[model samples]
Target: MKNIFIINGHQKYPFSEGKLNSSLIEKAEKFFNNKGFSVKKTTMEDNYDINEEIEKFKWADVVFFQTPLNWMGVSWSFKKYIDEVFSMGMMGEMSDGDGRSKEAPKKNYGLGGKLNGKYMMSVTANAPKEAFNNPNETFFNGISEDDLLKPMHLNFKWFGFETMPTFMAYDVMKNPEIESDFKRFEEHLTTNFK
Candidate 1:
């Protein structure tokens, strides 16, 4: 029974509402629940404790962050959750200023994460897949999902957690192939841990 931590950072307080993020979160919850794994879930709307998240992280063999891409980046709520859930006193001496950290302080991380012996992955949904593809003309960047999420991946790697391949569902909002993406995602979930 591998313990899993799932964070659904769809904020309803500091912002208006996020319907798609809610749906994706529910879908992910059911997916893990159906697998009979022990799962701990947190939604941004629920004023939950960061300690609970830490305890879950300590208990989990794996952690999954599932949510929609709000800006050209991750949701503000997700960033806040990361700040709260992965803050100091939890990372031991492995965190920054302990001398093991090699990251430049200007790059947005400072030895705060240390997910030793655990695995982490992401399920990110983006608005338009085509916009992020190579050779695109509009306001776009040509980076791949793994590249786009390199910061998060490296954060886990620095903390001693093995990071898995990021799973992305692009063109999620306007594409007609969303159901297909969901099916693929379902298959990904089943085969991922194996």
Candidate 2:
């Protein structure tokens, strides 16, 4: 990717100070820069202009999202951001807006993505990775961790961006192996981009 856009989706709250996400963002910025990719980033804490955020998407070849799972889903701020930004009609104009004519409301429901070939990758930090592996687990019954991000993948696909395999850091709050996780994440960036 020649130009990459990174969104740090962690919300600053009383429970978390957003340190891990910030560190990951810093590492990613430096790593990509060293490899000569033009990188741009924004944190949820920033004062963003709607137009500029859209412009960034237009300029990027790939987008990387960093987030923490709040209540098993993305934070409220990130969801709000998506709602506001994507509603501006970045997902192309179908013949009938959502590719559905009034006569056939169910025909082409979700095929209006504008950026056809651009890609996205998500890196999430959350509870223990093993929590979702057991058959008796409430979160996921032996499903891969990537499944937790299915909604996000579909959302990005709606905008026409191809999805990349996600990177994750588990047990972040309880007992994060920061050093090991960073190594693995660095390796992921290297292998995926190369």
Candidate 3:
């Protein structure tokens, strides 16, 4: 909780310029800074070194992801970043070769993480809140946001990181509630971190 690493996983498109995600990242940065925590950040649109990112993961006590849910998953650029960085990290930097050995190949599948930090994801989505956690909902059919984001959670789990509850600003495109979302975001940070 003392040192935090934030990843902004926003990829800009013609229709979506990533303003909301950027704003959320800014708010998180300010919150952590004011609380006297050391903060490091990365944006997918910017150039980064794989080794440096691994070092940041080692240094951080918590890793926060600020992303927009695009087509039910993270943006393509962020996915590429994950592939590159995590792939390089597999060389004992972040993990130790899938946490398995010749003695027991199937015993420990994903326990090769070198870092033991925590992770949280803050997401923006075009879908409404009601679309989730309601059995009547046609699309999700009672599936929660966390359920939708299980893959991303597993990614962090592979690195031995614990998961914090996720935050989501739903219906951002069709029903923008910028102010309310900002308020809730701040409250979430306070409730979780403070």
Candidate 4:
């Protein structure tokens, strides 16, 4: 069995109400539960613990960040969690490609991660996919999912852990698409965990 940490990085906001974020998070939670993984969940509005969550991160075999993308970026909760959690370790350490420091945590030891061996992925809800896909919009267009999450991915890489492919729900909250997104989140968990 795998240990999973689900970080609900959504803080209550105007655009965050009654949408894809809420539904998919519930779905993700149920899906993980059925898999028998010991799960720890943290919601943004709750007072957070840096060391405790980091300990959870170390305990996890897979860490899932379920959130809604806002302002063409991640939620403040996600950013705060990252800032608090990743700072405790030698998060950004790197040596020549050929070798790493032996005295400190190394990738081989799993402690090297900034929390390592643990897999991580992000499941995000966004506005209509088209809203973000156009090339004409200077601030929000012509960027693909991986491109948008480059900084985040780089952060994971800097710590020497592999990032799992993300699950994105576009135009979430409109009509039947919300249901489909939840279904996909469940599938994502089952597929990855198995």
Candidate 5:
């Protein structure tokens, strides 16, 4: 946890411009800097080199993803970024071909990751908190936030990164409690990082 890489995966739209995500990133950066940790960041809207991103992952002890949930998943642009960067990283940078060998090919699937860092995801969603973890909820049907974000988690797990508890700002669109969310976010960082 001495070094951190923060990725802002918010995609801009006419209705959402990623201001909240940016603020969260800023807060995390400040928190890490105050704790004497080295911090690096990438905003998906900006042009980036894939090699540099791999290097950042290699250098970091922890990678923090800040994203806005769109239609139950990360934005399309961020998904594209992940597809590109992680694909390139497969060449011995982040992983070394799916962790299986010719001798025991079927035994150790997805065990070939080269990095040993941890990853955490903080996401914003338009859906209300009550909609999740309730078996009576029609859509989610008792699914937790982490369950909904399993794909993203699996991506990191494929590269051998450990999971950190996820954070979410629920009801962000219809009935936002921006100030309370920010406070809770700071508390999250403190509780987890300390």
Candidate 6:
């Protein structure tokens, strides 16, 4: 059976209640459980043990992240989680982790990845999808997803995770379309993991 880890990267703000990501996490848990996969979850709103999180990453076959786009970046809570957890010497556990040492040159920077067979996928809620495709829009150079998610892609790659196709919701604040978005999310999960 596949082991799956899901992270709800939502943070409560004055205007945003973080309900969308909460619902998504619930849906994912139910879906993965019904599929007979071994599922693990982390809700960013809760207090987490850093070592446990690292262990979860090591144990899972795949990791799924559901996040909201805040000012073109992940929420501060989620970012802090990453910064703290990854900084706890997890990268050293990846491969040799001493690529900069004299024994291993910096040229082999990406060779030290422990979770080589693992995979990751992210679903982010942001502005309308049309804004990304419009050439006249200067917000993201017509590649909003890539523009916003490149850092995450590279970080996951450095950790030896093959990336799955990303899923996104557009115009969340103005018009949520929650039901349709959930349907597409289900489709995405089924299609990618099946």
Q: Give me the candidate number with maximum lDDT.
A: 3
Task: State candidate 1's TM-score.
Answer: 0.76
TM-score of every prediction relative to native: 0.76, 0.90, 0.98, 0.76, 0.98, 0.91
Off by over 4 Å in 4: 91-115, 118-120, 131-141, 173-176
Instruction: Encode model 3's per-residue lDDT on 64-141: one tens digit a residue.
Output: 999999889999999999999998888899999799999999888888988899999999999999999999998888
Which residue pairs collide, candidate 1?
Answer: 96-111, 129-171
lDDT against the true structure, per candidate, is: 0.63, 0.77, 0.94, 0.66, 0.93, 0.78
Model 5 residue 62 lDDT score: 98
| Positional deviation of residue 180's Cα in model 3 after best superposition, in angstroms | 0.7
Report the C-alpha lDDT of model 1 over 108-127, residue by residue, as the tens digit.
Answer: 34445455655545454545
Candidate 3 TM-score to native = 0.98
| lDDT score for candidate 2 against the true structure | 0.77
Runs with alpha carbons beyond 4 Å of true place in candidate 2:
90-96, 102-104
Q: Which residue pairs in model 3 clash with each other?
A: none
lDDT digits (tens) for residues 1-194 of candidate 2: 78999999889999799888889889888988999999888778878877788878877888888888887778889888887776765444311245566778888776666675455555555567777767777667777676777888877777678877688888888788999989998998888888
Which wins on lDDT, candidate 3 or candidate 4? 3
- The worst-scoring run of ten residues by lDDT in candidate 2 lies at 89-98
Error of 2 at 48 (Å): 1.2
**Lowest-scoring 10 consecutive residues by lDDT in candidate 4?**
90-99
> Which pairs clash in the backbone of model 6?
none
* lDDT digits (tens) for residues 9-124 of candidate 5: 99999999888999999999999999999999998899999999999999999999999999889999899999999999987889998888999978778788999999999999
Error of 4 at 48 (Å): 1.6
TM-score of 5: 0.98
| Residue-wise C-alpha lDDT for candidate 6, range 52-128, written one tens digit per residue | 88888888788888888888878899899988876663456544463456764657775556785455545556588
Q: 4 or 6: which has the higher TM-score?
A: 6
RMSD of each: 4.2, 2.3, 0.8, 5.0, 0.8, 1.9
